[model samples]
Target: MANQEPRVLIAYGSKYGSTKEIAVHIGEVLNKAGCATTVCPAGEAATDLSAYDAAVLGGGLYAGRWHRDAVRLAHRARRSLRKRPVWLFSSGPLDPSASEREIPPVRGVRRIADRLDAEGHITFGGRLDESARGRIARMIVKSGKGGDFRDFGQITGWAQTIARDVAARTGASRGT
Candidate 1:
């Protein structure tokens, strides 16, 4: 068979559960692609790196920052990540009229990426729920500019690409 299914760990830091859903979806996509995938909340510091061959990390962005837990996971895994493939993603920018941007300018994020030699970093549009937000976020949603902005097509496409790359790496390592 293939090379042990190329274990992949998908960790996410989510607020109001959006980012967690995204991470789970990525795991599903990768699993369908024949990769063994594990999905977890980054805050848990769960998913031991020894069990995975590659990793993808994501978080919900608030005020130009990735969730603290997500940053912590990246740092915690830095040494192990250096020996494997790594990818990063952030969900942000609630305004539909706004130009969508991926990847926040957080120093911790960039530092982790550099340490791990990340494979890719993506930014995705986010979901804004008035009921789930605070005064400011709720006010912003009330201003007639809030909804789920995540692009599934783009997310899935990226996951598929990762599937290909991870599969290749595993196969190569197995001498396939």
Candidate 2:
């Protein structure tokens, strides 16, 4: 495992694309850090984790729960994910809270993290714009409560941490 680049899967579920962008950013960081990374939506990711050495899964939070697709993927890939290093993340807070301090996973997400024995978890601020779908989403935006709050620097930092952990665990460092 130390001789070759670690293959990492980054799976995410997003409602309005912000979370997808976050996942992509993470993949880029991991790739630059010497890991082979695949970033895909949770629903599209393969259920088998046999091909990857580690995984980072994230989802958009909704009504205090994780995205359905992400939750389902975790259930389907639990056994395989358990055999590898797994990290989880949530993006849903529409304020600066996520960047200011640690946000514990909601009940459902916490359960998924526990089941997968995740190496770590994070909560990133979310984004809501006028283009958001659904009545409630539009209402929130119309009420002037929605805006992009994701912190890319914080996100990049977290991804770098995961890359280091992966390299340390796999005994391989691609770039250095």
Candidate 3:
């Protein structure tokens, strides 16, 4: 199976669509790098984790919590995720500082990733559109916050690293 390329599943939960966009972008980067990838909302992803050789799981952070669906997906796929390569990510900082240090896991979310032995976790910047804001969101925006903080270059760079790791582990790198 040295020649077999690894398959990846990208699962995400988004309260208002930011995380979903990030997940899709990750999938695109991996696919372009020669991995087969499946993208879906965390709730709709397969429970049979073995179907994917690796996984990239994440969701938006809101009110110091990971989305419920992201937690559920992790629990449902726990066994498989533990046996394979898994990475976790969260999109939450309305601030532009999306470095790993800024991307703290919300409440109980860290425990799930620790249990799954995920390889790494990323905290990317989030986007807030004023037009889509509810009254509360509007208030937050009015207080001098809220805008698109997502960086496509940063997202693709991380996914590219994952692609390299997958190829190395599976011995599936092209031009070999």
Candidate 4:
């Protein structure tokens, strides 16, 4: 039998590209941990969920909602993904102080994740560049004391954990 390492797909949606960068970092961590990984935008990924041993979905949150593409993908693949391992993550909450608070998961996205029985869920801090944001987004960010609030260390550590978990599960399944 062939002993191929498990394949992991990191799919994400980003408004200003911060979430895309986070997905790329997660893909790198998974690759370093020995899993084959690919990172792509949720709207552009053409691979079927069944082809991957594990999947990570990340998106930017706007107005307490995850990106539309992320939500759509989750719902569309929920059944096929139920038997596989999945992780859900969001990039939002620009306030560094807000990071310490127990912010509830975004409602619509959380429902999809719950249905899939995802292995883990996380909400990381996001960035808001007023110069790059659209009119409404710019207004919102400016109104809220805008600043970049991403925590790279925390993101890296969580990604490592996901990689480890994927490796272990894939190993155990092969043994069985």
Candidate 5:
């Protein structure tokens, strides 16, 4: 085999596009770490898994469920992914309470992680802007269940960690 760095795919499903940005950030981090990376919508990507050595899947959570495409991709690639490294993430949970307690665990990502033997799973705070929300989303915001709660720092930190892990894996595999 050629001594090329492993390829990393950051596939994401975004409703209002926040998750897409997060995936882009991850791709940037991986690229800086010397891996060939691609960031794309999960539904739009080719389903063949043989080309990637590592994968990161991200999505938006709506009413306790991940975007459909994310779920479908994970399910479709489950068998093949079991023999490789995979990471899962969701962008959701905007709690405005003053307490600094961690956001409650999302059952969907956990279930997917268990099924795929994912290296790690994460849930980040989501955003809610009444002006940008749709009818139902606006109603939910008006109902007192929404706020802008995204933490860019935490998201970037997580991406950094993932970069390091991917770099380490590629280095080890290449005996560098």
Candidate 6:
């Protein structure tokens, strides 16, 4: 793969579109770092990872559990994932705590990361708004607990690190 740009797939499972936005940002960062990236919802993600050199799987968190679609995708693509570098991320914290500290993956997410032998995992702040669906979401938003807490700077830095790691391993030149 020398001098070849790394192909990265970023798959996300989002209920209210917040997590999807984060996934897209990561894709943009990777792309700017010279990685060829594909971003898509986990449900719509391809089961085959053969076309990509690296993978990033992320999901929205609810009740301390990862989105069902993201979990299912991990299971479906476990074999392919193990053959390459994999990363995991979760977005669910309602406060700025995630931005202030390193929030570990929830239990189920940790297990999935372990199973996939992921290179890293991160938990970004979540977003809930009046437009969010579900009674609980609406309640949270109405109760004055809804807002976007994601830190794009952190997300971009993390993605850039991934890009550097991939480029180092593949011997590919990074974009200026």
Q: Estimate each model's TM-score.
A: 0.88, 0.97, 0.91, 0.89, 0.84, 0.97
lDDT of candidates 1 onward, in order? 0.80, 0.94, 0.86, 0.81, 0.78, 0.94
Q: Write the per-residue lDDT of candidate 5 for residues 1-176, one digit (tens) a residue.
A: 24577788899998877788788888876776667888999998666777888899988899889998998888887887777789888887767331245554478778889998899887877766676457888887888877777677777777778767766766634321
| Candidate 3, 52-82: lDDT as tens digits | 7889999888887888999999998898889
TM-score between candidate 3 and the true structure: 0.91
For residues 47-69, what per-residue lDDT tens digits would candidate 6 score against the true structure? 88999999999999999999999
lDDT of 2 by residue, 1-176 (tens): 66899999999999999999999999999999999999999999988889999999999998899998899999999999999999999999999999999999999999999999999999999999999999999999999899999999999999999999999889994642
Q: Name the weakest run of 10 consecutive residues (lDDT summed) in model 4.
A: 167-176
| Model 2 stretches astray by more than 4 angstroms | none
Q: Candidate 4: misplaced stretches above 4 Å?
A: 1-3, 172-176
Point out the higher-scoring one by TM-score: 2 or 5: 2
Question: Which candidate number has the best lDDT?
Answer: 2
In model 6, the Cα lDDT at residue 1 comes to: 81
Which regions of candidate 1 deviate over 4 angstroms?
96-107, 172-176
Which is better, 1 or 3, measured by TM-score? 3
Q: Write the per-residue lDDT of candidate 4 for residues 1-176, one digit (tens) a residue.
A: 13577898899988889899899998887787777888988988753677788999998998888988888778777787787899999998878843675456778877887898988788899888776558877786668756788888888888888877877877723320
Candidate 3 segments whose C-alpha is farther than 4 A from its true place: 99-102
TM-score for candidate 1: 0.88
